[model samples]
Target: MNHQTTTIDLIRHGEPEGGPKFRGSQDDPLSVLGWQQMRSAIQDEDQWDVIVTSPLLRCIEFATEVAKQRNVPLHVEDRLREVNFGAWEGKTTAEVIAAEGNKLSRFWEDPVANTPPGGETIIDFNQRVVEGWQHWRDQLAGQRALVVCHGGVIRMILADVMGIPLQKSFGAVSVPFACRSRIRVDQSDFGTLTSLHSHG
Candidate 1:
């Protein structure tokens, strides 16, 4: 069997209209600056064969614009959406910390073990993101693809590619707004993290 190399560029959505909150599953649109930030992040690149994005507004809006501009196919993938934060969905970190105290700290320390009150568990989130990633990898083999998604989604994908334990992945990866990460997978299905760039 001939294996082909696949290149995937993952980018976190820019700032949403809602400023600095948990934001998971909130469906907030991007702010004006968020639009500018995303535009600048891809201004120099136009080599994608396809664009895949989370269904959330923050990711899809920009993905739609870019796909139309470049004439590439765009796919809105629900599996790539940010992990549902449940009770913490719209609350700030400070708010969560104040309300949950040590619980928040424990969660940060070991998310796989300490899930948020109503949030998706780290294991489940990783599984879904990886499933989506594998589906694209197989479907778009040998092509360069762009994925516009959330910080959490990017982190989980990176962790999977790098063999980082899920328990350590949450804090181990820092995906700032408009951050771009590239992964190249060889015919053997081995993935390499080629580069990471952050607009901020």
Candidate 2:
């Protein structure tokens, strides 16, 4: 179906406590507030045609509950998973900072050629997620959708959609646990996007 318009509710999963050093790939459950955050977003909304979730349990914990309420089919997509931090998964942010120092900060500040040590590059990540989203956009056509995913992925989507440069995309946007960002995906000859924000 040619989807002329699609509403894609992009949501970031709940937060977690400081676990020594946190990095990508390590698994952690959402905090209590995280559940509360998800509750606020899902309970307030009554209808959703489909609910897609990240493969990680962090997002699944709250997403499962949302699906149960709306009786929406839950599909797990791996592409939405956070960037793989490889060996740095369990280390605390401080630990990684201390070990990598300026380089780590530089990666956060400017991930152009810099990348997480033993982790996926930002360019590859952007392409992976955008391609994944495009595939789904084609499938959804004229429909509303809800997807639960990670923070980094959400920022990447917003950055790409809003034309925000990835190097400076790590700004600490205060997103409450399980908070929802409702965006309408407009389809046109230019492709799917929101005119309100273009990728910077």
Candidate 3:
């Protein structure tokens, strides 16, 4: 898994003050334990070729620390940003449920077709994320890279690559804040296992 062609360690930034609650885009900095989580996630591993981040402040702060600790350049990719929660940006899940009632319950089933009040659709998210991956694939051919992104993006990547039904995306693993997901993609040979290969 170390020949080259990148073993992208996609990491979701730590939880900010309004995390696991509202706070979707816009701007929100990491909390105290969030910073600790970021430090712990990459402290033991310092061999990444490059550190890329989402434009969000939460991700940027953590990515900056990792870049400094590992002595690598920090690059920002807007497409790596989280799904815009729109009207729900600052509301709790329960609030959404109470507001939309039964309709809200179906969000997980057809988010691609449904719009979240004033937020981006699932289809839009998929498009942008894939675009981001392609951009990096071109630049990081035969190299290693580290990508900092959001929990939803990571879950989408896992769901799309693993062939999970789009409706079941919410069933993806519990992504701990600032944790690492090391995926090694091989261009020379294409296979599902190629994405699972990891060295660090």
Q: TM-score of every model?
A: 0.91, 0.83, 0.86
Instruction: Please tell me which model should have the higher TM-score, number 1 or number 2.
Output: 1
- lDDT (Cα, tens digit) per residue for candidate 3, span 139-185: 87666788888887877777656676666665445676776777776
Q: How accurate is candidate 2 locally (lDDT)?
A: 0.71
RMSD (Cα, Å) for all candidates, in order, is: 2.8, 3.5, 3.0
**Worst window of 10 by summed lDDT in candidate 2:** 191-200
| TM-score winner | 1
Position 162, candidate 2: lDDT:
74
Residues 1-200 of candidate 1: C-alpha lDDT, one tens digit per residue: 55577788899999999788998888899999999989999865559999999999999999999999999999989999998888888898999989888987787678899988888999999999999988997788889999999998988888877788888888888888998888887774454333333322
Question: How displaced is residue 45 in candidate 3, in Å?
Answer: 3.2
Clash tally, candidates in order: 0, 13, 3
Q: Candidate 1, 111: how far from true, in Å? A: 0.6
CA lDDT of every candidate: 0.86, 0.71, 0.75
Q: Which candidate order results from sorting by lDDT in descending order?
A: 1, 3, 2
List where candidate 2 sits over 4 angstroms from the true fold.
1-3, 17-21, 172-176, 188-193, 196-200
Please give the distance, in angstroms, between residue 55's alpha carbon in candidate 1 and its true position after superposition: 0.4
Task: Please give me the total number of clashing residue pairs in predicted model 3.
Answer: 3
lDDT of 2 by residue, 22-126 (tens): 446666877776666667666564567888888787787777877887787888888888888665677777777778777767766776577777888888888
